[model samples]
Target: MILNGITVGIILILIGLYGMIAKKHVFKIIFGLIIISTGLVLFFVSVGYVDTGAAPIVSGDTTYVDPLPHTLMLTTIVVEVCTTTLALVLALKIYEKYKTLDISTLEDL
Candidate 1:
């Protein structure tokens, strides 16, 4: 399960990298960043996973998953949302001023 999660996360990261690097539209680049953030969150969560692990509150001989990664990911998600929103707002403002979202066209203008 952990391996599967890691694989998916890596795939998402790759897709996001491609989107960011290959796409010319501002919104697409913003979406790529969002995807990368999501992939990072998934990767961290998978890294913290422990087989047969229980929450720290449980009193047993079972392994306990570290809560730090999960906590950090939660904070990351909040930050990602804020960053994405800001990026989108900036994109919108750019579009309103330039009337285009294409990076090349914007550059030429």
Candidate 2:
């Protein structure tokens, strides 16, 4: 199950990368970045997952899943939300100024 999650994450990352590279719209690129972030979070969580593991609390004779990744992902998700909001705000400003969301048109202007 963990491996499956990892694989799905990798695939999502790749798809996001392709969108960022091949898409012509700024919104699409922003969406791609969001997708990449999601994939990374998924991969990170999966990496720290342990089969039949208990919570990372102090306990005797209990296997604990690593908490570092979960902690990092929490921070990452906060940053991602901020970043996405900023990107969307910037995109809105760009649209207001240029009246278009197309990268090619923006370049021509």
Candidate 3:
């Protein structure tokens, strides 16, 4: 089960990377980044899981998933959101300046 999750997460991350390279559109790139982020979250979350456990907390009785990776994943997610937002903003700004979102025509700048 854990291996399966890892495999799926790697596939998702690879697909996202392919999408990033395959698309020339900036918005698509941002979406690709989001996908990548999701894949990373999945990967990290899976890494933190134990066979049988309860989430780590101040007061807890059962074994738990590794909280460190989960916490890191959470922070990574926030950073990913910010990255996508900034990507969108930059794309929009580029479009406004060039009147087109195509990267091919950006050479004149």
Candidate 4:
């Protein structure tokens, strides 16, 4: 399951990279960035997840899932949200000024 999640995350990241590079619309590029961030979060979480592990706070002889990845993911999510909001706001302003979201069109103006 963990490997599957990692594979999915990698696929998402690749798709996002392609979108960002090949798509001409600002919205699409932003969406791609969002996808990449999501993939990274997913990958990070999966890396630290243990199949037969208990919660980090649990006490016993059993394996425990590492808490660092979860903590890091929490921070990553917050930063991603803030950055995405900023990117969207900038994109909105760009659209308002140029009346179009196409990169080529914006470049012409």
Top candidate on TM-score is 4
Q: lDDT of candidate 2? A: 0.92
**What's the TM-score of each model vs. the native?**
0.88, 0.89, 0.86, 0.90
Task: Kindly indicate the candidate among 1 and 3 with the higher TM-score.
Answer: 1
**Candidate models: Cα lDDT each:** 0.90, 0.92, 0.82, 0.91
lDDT string, candidate 4, 1-109, tens digits: 3558789889899999999999999999999999999999888887888998888897768999888998999999999899989999999999889899999888889
Candidate 1 lDDT, 27-89, residue by residue in tens: 999989999998998989888878888875668577898788899998999999999999999
Report the CA-based lDDT of candidate 3 relative to the real structure: 0.82
Sorting all predicted structures by lDDT, with the top scorer first, yields 2, 4, 1, 3
TM-score of 3: 0.86
lDDT by residue (11-81, candidate 3, tens digit) is: 88998999898877777777788888888888888888788777788565778778998889889989998
Residue 106 Cα positional deviation in candidate 1, in Å, after optimal superposition: 0.6
lDDT (Cα, tens digit) per residue for candidate 2, span 2-68: 5587898898999999999999999999999999999999989878889899888977998888899
TM-score: the better of candidates 2 and 4 = 4
Worst 10 residues of 4 by lDDT: 1-10
Least lDDT summed over 10 consecutive residues: which range in candidate 2?
1-10
